[model samples]
Every structure is written in C-alpha cells, then in structure tokens.
Target: MNYRIEWKQILKNKEKVQCSSDWISAESAIQLGEELERNGKVTDLYFYDEMGVSWNMKEMRKLLLEIEEEPHDITLYFDGGFQKETYQAGLGAVIFYHQGKKKYRIRANNLFNEMETNNEAEYAALYFALGILEELGVEYKTCEIKGDSQVVLKQLEGEWPCYEEVLNRWLDRIEEKINKMGIRPRYTVISRKDNKEADKLATQALEGKEIYAKTIIL
Candidate 1:
C-alpha cells in the first residue's frame, strides 16, 4: 500500500490545503492521517481512497488498523488450458494475500466444457479468480493480475486489436466487472515457467482431479 502526504497549508500556524493524492493505498493514508492529527496543528485531515471516498482521521485510522488485522495486498495468478479433442477447458488460479504479518496462498482449479478456444478459456480463468476475490471481501484495492498467455495480456492491455466478436464481448465484460469492483489492476505477462503452478492445476482439473487448497506461508 502506498499514499501521498498532503497538508492543508492554512497559514494559521497549521497546514491548510486540500491535497488530492492519487493512487494512494488507503491503509497508508490512514496512518499518515493519524500522525498528522497528533500534531494538534492539523485542523482537518482527510483520507481519500482510490474510489474518491473521503475518510476522517479517526475512521480512517480505525479502518486501516482493522484492514491490517485482516488480509490485504492480494495477488492473483490465473491460467487455462483447452483440449481441442474434447473441447474441454481447464482453469486454474492462485491467490496470494497478506494478513497482518502473515502471508497466505489459495489455489483452485476447475474444468468446463463448451469453450471454443484456448483464449476464451484464459478469460474464463481470470474471471473465476475475480469471483473468488469478491467472495473473500477483498475489493477496491491495488492488485496484480497475471497470466502467461501473451495473447491474453496484449488483448487485455489494448495493445492488440480484438476483432472477434466473442473475444470482444468477453473483454468488455471484464472491463465492466473491473470497474464495478473498483479494482486497480496491475496486469503483468509472466513466463510459462513462472506460471507452472496454475498450469499444473489446470492440467489436473482436466484429468478429473479437484484441486482446492489454502495455506499460510511461514
């Protein structure tokens, strides 16, 4: 989590000015707000999240602390494999998160039929991971969404033109869902080696194995 420090330079022996810090981690902002309040010179402290919602010093501090007690700074990795012979798609996702000083990982996989292309399966895997994030009550935060598929990455980043109607619709749906969730996604393209866990999960799912595990990293 990152935040910008802002002072309202009032010139009345105190800082007075509306500081619009952009892309700040809400948790960090709350801590800064608390420190400012302790100065006694701060007439008002406001913490603005990425969603533009304002939080008072006390509320912001409490929320930040509570979030600290909970889990934050989530990373999700997703991948999919489509078997051309059977038209079966295998999906996999790995979620890494932090709670207090602890780190956790959640692994999941699924198998589905009816997907026409590997690309569509790739999109499905990402969408599935987001659904899990929503269930965990982690939204409106800075998150990294990664995949090994260059096609998926380029298409999502808008670097490549998507002419297929099916892919275009999937892309639009993803954009809409992301906006509604207020997520700031940092998309990255990783090598297949780095994405092996997810790849293996998908393969396992395709072989009729159910994979679901969550573990804490010591």
Candidate 2:
C-alpha cells in the first residue's frame, strides 16, 4: 500500500507548523516513523493510504505484520471473448500475487450466456476476477486491474462516458463490489499482445477447454 506521512514541525522560534512528506510505500513510511521516534522528534505521525484513510504507527505495524504471513499485493489481468454464433461470452482472468516471499499465479475462466456486447463481456471478465480475489482472502488491499478493453477501462476509470444502460449496470456492480471488499483498484489499459495470457484463457473457455490452476514460481 502507498501512504503519505504527516508530522508536526516546530521551529526554534516556537513557531509550529504541520509538515507532510511525499507519498511513499507503507513500509518506507513505517521505517521513517521509527527513525523519528528514535530522534525524539515524533510530534504526530499519521500515515494516509490511497483510500484516504489515516493510520498511526501502531496500526501500520499491525497491518504489515498480518501481510508478512500472506500476500497483500495483487495484480489481475482480465479478458472477455464473445461468440455471436452461440451468444456466449467467455471471461478470463490471470491473477499474480505473493505469499510471504513466494510468488504465484492463478488462471481462471468462465462462460456467460446473457452478455450481448463486447463491452459487457469485458465487464464480466473484471467481475469474475474480483470473485477470485475474494476466494483468495484479499481484503482492505489495493489490486491493480489491467485489461485490453479501452471501453471497460476508460468507463471504469471515469475517463470515458458510458452510454449503454446495460454497461452502466455492470459499472455499478463493479464499483459496489470494490467498495464492499474495501479494495482500492488501480486500472491500467494495455495492448492485446500484453494481455495474451488472459486472452488465451478466454479463447480456451469459449472452446470448452477450462483452465483453472494455481502454481508457485520458485
């Protein structure tokens, strides 16, 4: 997680002012906070996360300790493929995460019969990824959501306007689930070539070749 540090700065003339450091990772903030404590200049240490929530040194320590036993950083790549012939949408997701010092990847895909447009299918792919996060016990953490669909990425990031009623519904559901899980989502749009893993998964699902695996990278 990322956080900004705030402290009270007192001048030699007895003038008091509030000072803040640039946004940095939570681990760095904790290290800096500890240094301040040792120097006896710890006036007020506040750690502000990306979600706008503030945490003290104690809270930050506790959260980091919990994360040390499991992965807290996560990234998800999603892709959706729709076949007009069968009116079936195949949604796929590739998730990368860490458990302690070990890295792992998860590949999953599912098929939907109701989605009409390619945009709707893309949204379904993201929703499917979120379900996987829940299953992995990810909560109160940030997850990078990457996709090749400009429509889905731009609309979700509020950079582009969504006009379709069906797509708006999908948008609402995605936002609701993010808030419910206390997940801070970072959206990134990449090229189709960069999303080949999830793209292949979607195609495999369309062909009824389901892929669901979790493997560790030693």
Candidate 3:
C-alpha cells in the first residue's frame, strides 16, 4: 500500500500547520514515523492511502503485520484484433505476478463477435483481463496495465476523451470493477511492436487456438 504521511511538527510551544508528503510505501512511512517519534514530539501523525482511507499509526502497523512477508507485484498486458469482415474480435492478455518466492506468468485469450469496432474490442480485452485478475483473487494493490491501443489506454487514463457511447459504457464498467476491488491501476501505452506477445495471442484467438497457461519462473 502507498500512504501520504501527514503530521504536525511542534515548534516553539506552538503546533505548526499539518504537513503532508507525497505518497510513499507504507513500510517506509512507518519507519519514518517511528523515527520522528523517537527524536521528538510529533502530533497528529497519521496516513492516508491512495484511496483516501485514513489510518492511525497503530492501525497501519497492525495491518502491515497481517500482510504477507513478501509483497505483491502484478503486471498485465492486453491486445485485441478485430476483423471487419467477420465482425469478430480477438482478445488476449498476459499476466505476470509474484508471491512469496515464486513468480508466474499466465496467458489467456477470448474471441467475441459483439464489439462493433477495434477500440471497443481493445476495451473488452482489458475487461477480460480484469476478470482473470478476479479469478486470481487480486485486490487492494497496485497493478501495471499495458496495452497497444492508444484509444483504450489514453481514455482510461483520462489523457484522451472518449466520445463514443459504447466506449464510455465500457469505461464506466471497468472503473467500477477496479474500484470495487480497491485496485490502483496504472496504464501505459506501448507501441504495437513492443506488444508482440499479446499481439500473437490475439492472433491465436482469432485462429481458434485458445491458450491458458501458468508457468513458474525459476
């Protein structure tokens, strides 16, 4: 979890205004808070997470204690291919995650004929990946989402406006799902050439060759 550190520094028998720092890792925030307490009196020491949930030091420490010793690191790559003649869209996703001492990668794909355009198909492919994350029980963490579709990535990131009604609906649904999971999503737009892995999987989907695999990295 990431937290913004906020506290009041005592100065000359007066409490200065509360100061806040940019979000930092929870572990680092805790250590800094402890060090501040040891050096001198600090008042109103607390933290606010990315979702704006406030936490007292005691509560944060307790929660950190409950978390696994190893941290969660997850990345998702998605691509979509649409055939105008067939009106079929192929969606593909590659997910990499780590837990304890093990790292794993999963590849999956789907073919659907419902989307009307390639942009819509791109959004659908990303949504499909969210479903996979749900199956993996991912929640309350930061996830890196990368894709080749500038429309999908920029719109989701609010860097570009989405004027299409269908795409707006898909955007709303994706936002709702990720918010419900307390997920902090970071979107990166990559060149098509840089997204060959997902591109290949999407082609395979279009060809009726489905893939779903998990491989542990040694």
Best by lDDT: 2
Clashes of each: 7, 0, 0
- Name every residue pair that clashes in candidate 1: 2-25, 8-15, 8-16, 8-17, 9-16, 9-17, 10-16
The segments of candidate 1 whose C-alpha lies over 4 angstroms from its true place after superposition are 9-28, 36-44, 69-71
* C-alpha local distance difference test of each model: 0.81, 0.88, 0.86
Q: Could you estimate the TM-score for every candidate?
A: 0.82, 0.91, 0.82
Candidate 2 local lDDT, 1-218, one digit each (tens): 67888888667776767888888876788998888778765577788888888888899899778776766779999999999888899999999988787899999999889778888889999999999998888888889999999989999989999998999999999999899898989999999999999999999999998889999978
Model 3, which residues run further than 4 Å from truth?
12-17, 66-71, 100-103
Give per-residue CA lDDT, model 1, range 110-194, as digits (tens). 9988889999999888888888887777767778899998887799888988888888887888888788777888899999999
As for TM-score, the candidate ahead, 2 or 3, is 2
lDDT tens digits, residues 1-218, model 3? 57888988888877577777787877788898888778676788888887788889899888676544433578999999998889899999999887656788999999988679999889889999999998888888789999988879888989899889999999999999999887899899898988889889989999999999989988
Q: Judge candidate 2 at residue 108 and give its lDDT.
A: 97
Ranking by lDDT: 2, 3, 1
Runs in model 2 deviating more than 4 A are none
**Model 1: lDDT of residue 10:** 55
User: How high is the lDDT of residue 99 in model 2?
Assistant: 76
Top of the candidates by TM-score:
2
